[model samples]
Target: MRTRAKICGITRIEDIHSAVNAGADAIGFVFFPPSPRSVTQEQAKELIQHVPAYVQTVGLFVNASLDEIEQILKQAPVDILQFHGDESPEQCQQISSQVGRRWYKAIQVKPELDVINTIKSYQNVGASAVLLDTWHPELKGGTGHSFDWSKFPKLDIPLILAGGLKPDNIEDAIKTTNAYAVDVSGGVESAKGIKDQQLIEQFMQGVQRGSAK
Candidate 1:
């Protein structure tokens, strides 16, 4: 199967268009208020309106409460909900079912953690898929730091490779890990929350070329 591309941290309508034109299968909207990429519900609603029906719209949250998740769901109709925080499988499933959307769990891989058990934890939580991200003390994703691909363990669920992916290294990432899809945020931006079209295209090109190999 062809690799899927998700151009995350989209905050503008034009950027959404660029991602779609570049063949991105999904677009991410940040609901967390702490990060620079965080966008308000009103802004996301307006931006989401311009997106086509086929492309998925993902909402990123960092340990968000059920109330907050419900609020966003009411304000905007997100196609998928990405729990990017340290949420338990129960929490992930609860909010996902409450909102009635597909939930993908994010695993913060540390040095000593057992990779297989990590996958099992999310699976037990009822996540449809998992995103492998670099764990850091100060950051809540979009950190642009990559983990060791050799550290990746085998799994059957859909894997989305995140953290520090760029046009230059994306091909190798896919070839080595054979991830079903890739998620990127700061890798394609000149500044926080702002997308660079050329970089976006280059990233997509790299994904296509990598999958072909």
Candidate 2:
């Protein structure tokens, strides 16, 4: 199957068009306020307008309450919800069901952790997919740090390789992990929350080359 690409942390309408025009299957919007890439419900509503049909819109939340998510959905109803915080499998399922949307759970990959079991726990609970990302003590994601690709194992569900992915290394990442998809934010951006069109194109090109192998 072809590897899918999701361009995340989108802040501007131009970025949305850039990502879509560059063949991104999905566009992400951050709902968490602490991150510089975060966008308000209003901003997401306007930005999502530029996204054409068949290109998914994803909302990233960091331990947001049900009320908060519901309220945000009122204005900007994203196609998928990505839980990027310390949420349990039960919570992820609960919130996903309540919100009436499929969800992807982000796993912070570290050397000491039991990668297979952890991924299985979320998979058993019905996550649409598992996104493997670099682990950090304080930060949730967008760390721009990569974990050991050799640590990856064959899985039953679709795995989305994230963290530290850029035009330079994306091909190797895909070949090594054989990930069903890839998620990128800062890697394709000229600055925080601002995506570079040229970089986006390069990243997509890398994806195509990787998938071909």
Candidate 3:
């Protein structure tokens, strides 16, 4: 199967068009207030409206309350919810089920954690998939750093590789992790929250080449 590409941290309509035209499988919008890429519910609604069918729109949240999420969903219709915080599996399930949307839990890859077990724990709680991102002391994600790819473990659930993936390294990342999909944010950006069309296209091409092998 082809490794899917998700061009995340989209803050512009042109970037959405570029990602779609470049064959991105998913587009992500941040709802975390602290993120530079974060968009208001109204903004996300406007942006999501432009997304064509079959191209999934994902909402990224970090430690947001259920009420906050519910309110956002009422305005912006996202196909998937991504939790990138210290939320428990139960919390993820509660929020996802309450909204009736499939969700993915992002696990910050750290040296001490048993990554496989962590994924399984979230899977048991009804997470549709698990996203692995490089861990940062002061950040949840979008740190633009890579973890030790060799440390990846085999998983039954869908695995999404994120963090520090660029055009030049995406092929290697896919090959190393055998991830079901790849999520990129800062890697495709001209600046924080600004996606570059050329970089997005190059990253997708790299995913194609890597998955083909």
Q: What does candidate 2's lDDT look like per residue over 18-46, in tens digits?
A: 99999999999999999999999999999
TM-score of each: 0.97, 0.98, 0.99
lDDT of 1 by residue, 1-213 (tens): 789989999998889999999999999999988989999999999999989989999999999998998888788888999999889888888888887899898887788878788788878778888999998887878878999988776788888889999989999999988998999989999899999999999999999988995
Model 2 accuracy (lDDT, Cα): 0.94
Q: Give the Cα error of residue 93 in candidate 1, in Å.
A: 1.0
lDDT of each: 0.89, 0.94, 0.94
Worst 10 residues of 2 by lDDT: 110-119
Q: Is candidate 1 or candidate 2 better by lDDT?
A: 2
lDDT, residue 79, model 3: 96
Q: How are the candidates ranked when ordered by TM-score, highest leading?
A: 3, 2, 1
What is the lDDT for 16 in model 1? 97
